[model samples]
Target: MDFRLTDDQRALQAGMRTLLAARYPRERLRAAVDAPHGRSEVLGTQEGAGAPGVHGAAEPAVDRRLWAALGETGFFALRLPEEDGGAGLGLPEAVLLFEEAGRALLPGPLAATQLAAGLVPGAADGTRIVTALDGPGVTAHLASADAVLLLTGDTARLLPVEGGTGPRALAAAPFRSVDPLTPLHRVRELPSPARTAALGPAADAARLRREAALLTAAQQLGSARATLALAVSHARHRTQFGRPVGSFQAVQHLCAQMLVRTDLARAGVYAASLTEAPAEIMGAKLLADSAAIRNARDCLQVHGGLGFTWEADIHLHLKRAWVRACQWQSTEESEEFLANELLMDAAGENAPGVWWDTLGEENVQA
Candidate 1:
C-alpha cells in the first residue's frame, strides 16, 4: 500500500501542527511540568468518590481550556462516525493529529480519550476525559479521567471515575511516574464480582488494541522527529571553538543517524496505520519506540552538558519517550510478540514435518 500522505492529509497535519504550536507552547509545557502535583481543580477525588469501595489520591487536573479548544477543533472526534457528531475521518487522520500532539508534548489522556470518543458519553466533545489500561496494572490520567476503559481479553468495560455506582469498581493507588506530564494510578482491583458495562465484544476489543498500539507508535514517531529537529537546530546554532558544532563530522553523523531512524520508524508507523495487521502494528511499535528513545539520547549527546539541565527541553522529551515506551506495549514485550509471530508464520509456511528437520544442514548442526 502507498504510505505517502494525500494532499488533504498533509493539510490536516499542518493544521494540527499549527494548533498545537499555538496552544501548547514551550512555556505552557514547562508550566505543566512545574505545576503542583497533588492539587486538584476538577473531577475525581482522593477518596472513593466515584465507587464507594475504590480509593486513590487525586491527580492534577487537565488543561480544561486547551482540551476544549482541541474538542472544538474535532481532535477527539476525528474517528467517530458522522452521525454521532464526529469529523468522520479514519485512523490515518487520527494518527496525524496524535503525531502533532506528541511533537508539542501536549499532556492529558489524549489517545485514550480519542479511542473512547464514540463509546463513552461526552468523550467526543472532550467534556469527559478517559483513560484506558489492559488488565489494570498502572494507568495514566485516572484522577482526571471521567471514565476508564478496561480492556480484558475479548472484552472491554467502561468504569466511570467520577460518579460510578456500579457493582464493580477499580481500586487505585498513587504511583510515581518518570514522566511528570503523565500522572499514574495503580489499579489494585478491577472488574470485580460484577462486571462494568461492556462496550464491545472480542473483535472490537482486538481492533481497539491495534489502533491503540498504532496511535502510540505515531506519538513515538512524533517525539523522535521533534528531537531530531532540536538536535539539528542546536548543532547548527551552538558554537564550539568558534565553529558551529554541526560542521563537525561527529555531530553530522549523529544527526544523520537520528534522521535515518526517525524516517524508518515513520515508514513503519504509516504503513501499519494503513494495514492494521497484528504483526505490522507490533513491528511499528518496536521501531518507533527504539527511534524515540535513541533519538532523544542522541539529541542529548549532541547538546552535551547543557542537555542534562532541567531547564532544557531535551530531558522532558527523553522522559516522555521512556514513559511512552512502556505504554500500550513495552520494548521487550513487542519484541517477544513479534518473534512469536515470526515463528508462527514460519511454522505455518513449512510443509508437514518436524520443524527442526526443515532447516539446512548448517542450521541443524547449530
Candidate 2:
C-alpha cells in the first residue's frame, strides 16, 4: 500500500484534529481529571449511568453526547462493514483516526471500543462501550465497558459487563491512572457465574491482537509527533542568556534526534499496518514505544523546570506516553519477541526442526 494520505484521508485528519483541539481543550481535560470518577463534567457524564441505554445511564465517566458525536464521526464503526451498518473502512483509515485521538489525548479504551463495534451490540452506535482485553485474569476500563473481550491463550470470549439489574460487577475497584484524565479500573475480582455472549478460536484472537497493537502504535506515533512539535515550539520561543533557547546547538541536536525517532517510528507503524508479518508488527511496536517515551522525556528536558510543574500540559502527554508504553506490549516484551525471531533465523537448521521449518518458510516469503 502507498501509505500516502488520500484527499479524503487528509480532510478527515484535519477535521478530526480541529474538532478535538476545540472540544477537548487542556482546561477541559484538567477539569475531567479533577472531577469525580463517574461525574466528569468534561465528558457530560450521566447522573448514574448504570445501564445499556444512554438516555438515563448514570455515573458514566464519558459524555453521552460526546460518544454520540464520536459515532457520528464514524469513530467506532470505522472498520466495520458498511453492509452491517458500518462505515466499512480499513485498517489504514482507522489508524489515522486513532493518531488524531492520541494527539488530542482523548481518554478511554479507544482501540477496544473500535474493535467492539463489530462484536458488541450498540457499540458501533456508541451506545455501548467495549474494552478489548489482552488477558483473561485482568483488564482495564472494566467499570466503564459495556462488554469485554477477554483473550486467553488464543481464545476470545465476549463477556458482558452489564446485567439485568445493572452493570455487572466485572472488577474489584477502580485505580487512579498516572494520567489522571485516563482513569482505569481493572478486573481484579470477578462476579461469580460469569457469562459470555460469544466465543471465537485462536485466529480471531490473533487478529484482535494485531489490530490492538497496530492502533496503539498509531496513537503512540501521534503522541511522539505532538511532543516533537512541542519541543520545537518551546525551543524557538523560550530564551536563555541572550539568544532564543532553540538557537543553542544542544537544543538543535535534541530536536533533530526527536524528529528522527518520530519519523522512523511512523514509518515502522505505517508499514506494519500494511503488512501483517508478526516480526514487523513487533518491530513497529518497539519503535513506537521508544519514540513516544523518549520524545516525551526529551521534550520535557527542553522545557526545563516548567516540564516538572503540575500546571504544565506537557506532562500530560508524557504521563500518557509512559502509561501506554507499559500496556499492550512493554519494551522488554517487544525486544524479546524480536530477539527470539532473530535467534530463530540465526539458528537456521543447526538444531530444532520446528524452528528450522518456521525460519525456512519465513525466508521463502521474504
Assess the local accuracy of residue 31 in candidate 1 as a C-alpha lDDT between 0 and 100. Answer: 77
What TM-score, over all chains together, does every model reach?
A: 0.87, 0.84
**Model 1, span 1-366: residue lDDT tens:** 787889999999999999888988898888777655422333233542222211233345577788888988899999877988987999888888888888888888788888888888888887887788887677776666778887765776787766421112466765566776676667766765264677855327667877888898899899999999999999999999999999999999999999999999988988888888777898999999999999999999999999998788888889889888888888898887666556546666432212233342322221
Clash list (residue pairs), candidate 1: none
What are the per-residue Cα lDDT tens digits for candidate 2 across 313-360?
Answer: 678788888788777777897887676667667765333223333345
lDDT against the true structure, each candidate: 0.78, 0.72
Task: Return model 2's CA RMSD, one decimal.
Answer: 6.1
lDDT of 2 at 170: 55
Model 2 lDDT-worst window of ten:
44-53
User: What TM-score would candidate 1 get against the native?
Assistant: 0.87
- Candidate 2 has a TM-score of 0.84
Model 1 per-residue lDDT at 185: 67
